[model samples]
Target chain A: MKRLMNRRPNRASKIFLGLLPFIIILLVYASASSQRLAENADDKLLPSFSSMADAINRMAFQEDKRTGQYLFWTDTWSSLKRLLTAVFFAAVIALSLGILLGVIPYLHANFSPLITVISLIPPMAILPILFIVFGLGELSKVVLIGIGITPFITRDLLARVLEIPQEQLIKAQTLGANTWLVITRIVFPQVCPRLIDALRLSLGAAWLFLIASEAIAADGGLGYRIFLVRRYLAMDVIIPYVVWVTFLAFMTDYLLRKFSKFAFPWYYQASNKA
Target chain B: MSILLEIKNVWKQYGDAVVLEQLSKCVSAGEFVTIVGASGCGKTTFLNMLLGTESYSKGKILLDGKPLPSEPSQDRGVVFQRYSAFPHLTVLRNTMLGAELSASPFLGIVFNRRKFSAIREKAEKMLESVGLSHALNSYPHELSGGMQQRLSIAQALMKQPRMLLLDEPFGALDPGTRSDMHKLILALWKETGITIFMVTHDIEEGFYLGTRLWVFDKVRFDPHNAEAYGAQITYDIDVDQSAKRRLKKELELELEKSEQAFGASE
Candidate 1:
């Protein structure tokens, strides 16, 4: 049989490659837990997979006595809503302002310095300020995420917009496109996929802000649940919650990548050239 | 034929550096004019001035005996060396852009069923004429150099401008592709009878395509104050008498003699 020089691995092998790391981590944890349990039959730090699985099942499927709602599902929903809302607002604002700054010289000259200054300020430093101004409710948490990630998104998108070739702009003008027309037909389409990419890069910061806010004051969120479990030395709940948050973040990033690829195949095609 | 474009005693300067001085030329209706010059000879500067994108320091450009506007207009369509077609649009959409833009409102082009079909039909016809019917769905980057140039020409002509400006439009193509482009351009010129003003460094291309060829170079340069001088029209030949085959040698001799006489070896 003839074999290609750079053949791709089969799907089964690829899946196994992806799962290899998690399997290693689980085996290591299980071995450590067994060693600890053999010495002292009451070790909480390294609970076995069965105990962790049981804890997740009860949290996800069983109703809580106090709230009469599945805490895990409720926490996931609340955290997702805040993160998505903040991310949505940040994307819209950044795309609009970034493109405006990039296209119009006058606006750029006037506003770029201010945006740069604001971007330089660390977002975490303002978490307390956000809570004070917006109150310790959902508004504060969402706004914290927005403030935390908007600057990064705006700067990234601004660079992308600026990177568009001067020839394209002049060509658009020669095609009888006015300022507004150029923005809509040329700049708008090119910047959209870049905005999605910028959003994906900023998602990590978004999650960080969401978790920090929830850990500080929220009653129902993934971060809040993790911190609450920490006080009781409930390592099982803490570890499972952390894993679930990671899984959710990974899914969001994956879906966004797929969406951008499907939405702007031309952009991807040009970029992926050899 | 009446004069369609007249440039009278035009002078251009950039800060203290003079680029063009007392440049006077005119193109009659339906005439094809090709401009050739060495680098830094203000050929592109003159072309931009004609397009009305760059403001001349001192002069008036009259189109149809009326002063041309100071900004780009649909009356003049320009095709650059490359990057002419919008990268994001497919070949068909690139051609359709002009018609759709003129038909649609200022804010945006409303894509109605009837207008869209009509515009599509017109664009398809133009694409077919330019020999890009098979690449209707291909993006600009997907096409070869020759195909991209053809698509850009189609895109420019779709607007039905009175004058087409070509700035080294085929400079980047290989020799074979360049000759094919020459044929395409001549056919389009003869068919439409639209006026053309092309700037090129290729001396042969300028002579082959132009009915009236203009040679531009810096006639007056000071070694100490070089920036004070600017290029002028050194030769304006009516190529109707020079047969296409013989023109190359004849012009080569002419250019060599002029270079020796003026000590402008470049």
Candidate 2:
């Protein structure tokens, strides 16, 4: 007889095991919703699935009477635009600054402590300051997300650059590479894949900062709509918006991982120990 | 042959701990110099100095009577024991890296298609010479240890360097692969007539591969403070065929006694 710890599930059983908890949670929610609805027809806490479905259709398919726009699509588009713009700028800054700090001792000595201090400072604590300086507009939201994740990503990329074996750098120099050449030829290509990985890890934090900023001050965004509906206790709309945001985050991570594997196959090969 | 390199009383120290002291030697052109020593005897430090990756505390090194550059340059090539090849590059790209860097100093890339193809062709020839033609498109991680070393050798040779520094290049290979690599390296050395400096832990390998064998040892040991003294070149023996045959037995016995002493100290 195999011990419990030694027992391994096959592929089909593993999939079944993974879905068991989600299924149980959904069942629990359905029963609770039915019980609450039985007592009061206007229970706002956990609206029945049908009401949530109607809410989704109204928000996504029907045009708003006031704005004459499909709220769901407009909010998603504006949110994604801000998030992607912030992330793009953050990635560029992280790669260039990370490589500079890692390779040059003079820069490292001067700036490493400063980066460490910046990373230690809570990004959320500076939100009000950002809003005041950049104004309560798209710029503030974008800057919030950028500031929230750039230091972390830069630190991650700097560690990756430093983790490169000293032998490789020496070999590059022996191969007639000057400092700039080494950065472009050896360090840049190697760090690009790691930069993708860092971006994937920081995406969750980026979304958090984006939502917090949008909830405070935004004309149109997913977070703005959620916060706006919260005033009326509209859990149906909020729940769907939260799930959509999660799905979008998952898709971004999945795409970035796939792109890294495709563009830098050697990185995966080396890291996988194949 | 004229002296290609001269070391004038070079000393290397890291703060209070001295590594090498008063090392002076002249290496002629086309000489195969193999260095053997006990662990922590500064042999790798000496090799790093020759490779220009480490700076000595005193004295100087001259290449063709000119002061050797403090930093590594194209005239010298080095292959470390492991991780000599870039993990991100295919074998062909790794081999072409030196040529591309030399051709485009700033960019380290050949933008012209015809020029890029010429570099690629030269890289293919270099890889073929090292018997890695089939694995040109493969990443370094895909190759076995022996094949990786061969790729490193090919990469080092791409610049047509005048001096080749190999730091225990075959140390990580199995016995069978090590022997094969020995034959390959000896053939390459014979054909290219490049000056070679190799550091190895195996005395027998030193005797077999080198025209001159250098032994580094500590003459003075401080019981209270180990860093008080540094290692020096204690023995420099010419390795002719007759001397190799005669001295091999003596060195093996000496190595055994030293190993026993080292074990007892532990």
Candidate 3:
């Protein structure tokens, strides 16, 4: 019965379910704000109008009322889009660099200490230098996150690559495996899952740095938008942006972990036994 | 009978200490020869010599009428006390590697499903011979000690080597598994018709496994002790002198005891 119930969701169902909750939430908030406006406008025309919701709804839409109330939502989307793009680019560049640095023997050995020491320093410690050199632009922001994320992923993967057993190497050797075959067929497969875990860990750091990235110099990201709203002392927009960034970060982290679980089930399953 | 593999007055040393001193032995093809002794008697050194891995300080050795080479090859398969296989590779791949190398170009070509299928089929046949057909896809770490050793045996036989050298192969296994493995090995040797040379300290293990067994004295002897004695080395001279005489006397006593014991046991 469980197997029968496990029929995969259709593409249409997946899209609908994906968009359903956000659409409903947007409608609810927009309607609540819209209704509040209608009630307040009518209250001004009449006398003896008293509802505690008027104060709360006015507070909710306070920042949105600055321009067209819908601009608030658009600004939030634009900010998320900018940061997600930064994250996407950072993740791609960082994972590639990480895999390369992690696998190369000379690079891993020679620069591992430097990489360890580099990851230890806080992102902001270098943020000022990065801002000075790259001048608080988009380049500096993305590059900063990429630089920070690369070592985190690569070092973890290098440690994992080192941990594959000597017996495994001997087994390959006695079996007549060539050096390249041993690395590709044996080492790669064994380390691939661990690399995935390291990549996921780097993704979390990338999100963190992306927010801190807007701290450098940016017209609009979740970070910049948070600071922008802070000027007006509007906690409402800031709170929502915080919530959205948290949700996005959680979703990405959760999905990567889930994908790894599905892709390399043996790795985690076997380890969890002991 | 023609000599198949011969170790002629071979000497092996581990650092300053000699393990095998001018040891000589010959094993014809299809013969089963076992070396028996107490621990550290250099029986394993003899097996290593046949496998062409251990270097001797002096003398010559031959395998199948050829001078033993510098390096051991797939022509000789060795099963050690511990199973040796890549923990990453599946058993089928492990077995296939032994057979595939040193053959025709057909052997070198992998990833061709047809060729791999054939080698895999042969590997399966070998695994079944050793009762490990169920573990074809399993890695080394997944196997039990006995199963791993069986896999090691199967792995060695995959190449159909001219000789198989086992150095206390079943020593690490439990008694029940050891007995089972011994029987299985004997059956394998009988079926395969390859020469078998093994070293074992366990008397019953040596007895049960080898068709021809050579027992070494429990203590190694040095004849030059008396010639080198000095005032400072007086105790060494006395101990070596007494030890030498005692060893000869002990051998005589042991021979008498063995004969009597054999007569009684029979």
Candidate 4:
């Protein structure tokens, strides 16, 4: 018989182990909700699973009395639009700036310190300033998300570009590559997969900035809906919304990971060895 | 024979520390010149100077009686012991990269199907010559050390460079693979008649592969400060095939003694 320290779980046991905690949490929540409901039927803090289901149906399936809009779907659509647009803009800006700073010695010398300083500043501290300048509309929310993640992603990508082997660059130059050709053929291709990785890592921060801006000022969004229902103690709706947001974030990260593997198989292979 | 490259009293220094001092040599076209030296003898630095990646502190390196460019150009191709091949590119793409860069200087890609195929065909032939034809689509990381070195050679040869610089290219390989690489390099050298400058730690490899062998050693020594003096080409011997076997034993003993003396000086 193997000692406990030496013992390792098989594939099936590993899967079971992973799910055990989630199952326990769910069971505890269900028991607490039942007990609270038994003590006081009017309890709103820990709503029953059935009531949460009912809230989802109302928000998603049923039309809102005032706007005649399916509140849940509208909130999801608007939030996704802002998030995707901001992310796209951030990615383009970060990639361009990162590559420029990484490749050109003068630009790197001048801008790297500035970028580092910007990254050090807490993005949320400038939330009020962003809202005032860009207004309380969609622009402000998008800008907040863009500003929040751009510096981090840019720094990450810049480091990746710098990490490229010097010999490879010399090799490229020897192969008849000029500066432009070296960047495009060698540096750009190598930095792309790393850009994807940087974006994936920054997604959590992006979402935080998005939700904070939306909660502070927005016509309709997942964060807006969740915060608005707090007055009525609508835990049923809030809980479901939070779970949905988590699922969306997870799905985005999953898709990005899959896409990176598909598009840059070589990068993944090299990283796996390292 | 025409002199392809000439070094006229070249010196390389970083800050106050000298790496190579007053190095002078003239290399003819199609000659295989192998360099052997102790570690930190500035052999790699000298190679980098010829490749135009490193600037000389003084004097000049002339190619075809003209001052060599301060930056690397297509006329010279280089292969390091590692990181010579791009990890992200497949074997075929790596080979095709040189031609592609020349074809589309700005973009470094060939968008036209016919042009792309032509480059691809050329790359395939180069890979076949290097014996890496079967692993065309495999990335560099997937390759064994010898195979990666083969790929590096194929990639370098793709440009049809007039001069090839190899910096300890087979240092990482096993003995069997190193011997195999030796055959491949000699065959390529004979067929293409490209002037070769190879740096090796193994003195035997230098004698075996080169038409001429150079030994780099520092003459002046400062016991208190190691950086006070830099290495110079101390010995240059012409190695004809007939005389190589006879010269090997004597040269090996002499170099060993000198190497021991160099260590003692330090």
Model no. 1, DockQ: 0.60
The C-alpha stretches of model 3 lying farther than 4 A from their native spots are: A1-124, A127-143, B1-110, B135-143, B161-169, B194-203, B211-266
Two-chain DockQ for each candidate model: 0.60, 0.86, 0.13, 0.88
Model 4, residue A194: distance off in Å is: 1.4
Writing each residue's lDDT as its tens digit, candidate 1 over A28-125 gives: 98899999888887788888888889999889999998889999999999999999999999999999899999999998999899989998888779
Q: What CAPRI-style quality would you assign to candidate 4?
A: high
Candidate 3: RMSD to truth: 11.9
Return the top candidate by DockQ: 4
lDDT for each residue of candidate 3 in B1-266, tens digit (9 for 90 to 100): 67887778766665665555655666778878766654444566666666665677777888877887655665677787763664545777777765554332332437667877888889899999999888788866778899988888888888777888888888888899999998999999999998888877665565566666666542333344321211110011112334445544454465455445334432
Q: Put down candidate 1 lDDT per residue, B1-266, tens digits, no spaces.
A: 99899898999999998989998888898999999876767889999888887889887889999998787878888888987887788999899888877777475465698989999999999999889999999999899999998998898898888799999999999999999999999999999999999999888888889998898877776867767888899888788644656667766775665455445433
Q: Each candidate's interface RMSD, rounded to one decimal?
A: 1.6, 0.8, 4.6, 0.7
Worst 10 residues of 1 chain B by lDDT: B257-266
Just chain B of model 3: what TM-score?
Answer: 0.79
For model 3, the local distance difference test gives 0.65
What TM-score against the true fold does each predicted structure earn? 0.93, 0.96, 0.60, 0.97
For candidate 3 chain B, the 10 contiguous residues with the lowest summed lDDT are B229-238
Task: Give per-residue CA lDDT, model 2, range B1-266, as digits (tens).
Answer: 99999999998999998889989999999999999887777899899888888899999999999999988888899999999999888999999999999999879999999999999999999899899999989999999999999999999999889899999999999999999999999999998999999999999899989999998877777767777778888778998999988888877776666555434433
lDDT of 2 by residue, A1-274 (tens): 9999999999999999999999999899999999999999999999989999999999999999999999999999999999999999999999999999998989999999999899888988999999899999899999999998999999999999999899999999999998899999999999999999999999999999989988999999999999999999999999999999999999999999999999999888788822
Q: Give the Cα-based TM-score of candidate 2 against the true structure.
A: 0.96
| Positional deviation of residue B223's Cα in model 2 after best superposition, in angstroms | 6.4
Q: What share of the true interface contacts does candidate 2 keep?
A: 0.89
Which has the better TM-score: candidate 2, or candidate 3?
A: 2
- Model 4 error, position A143 (Å): 1.1
Report lDDT (Cα) of residue B18, candidate 4: 87
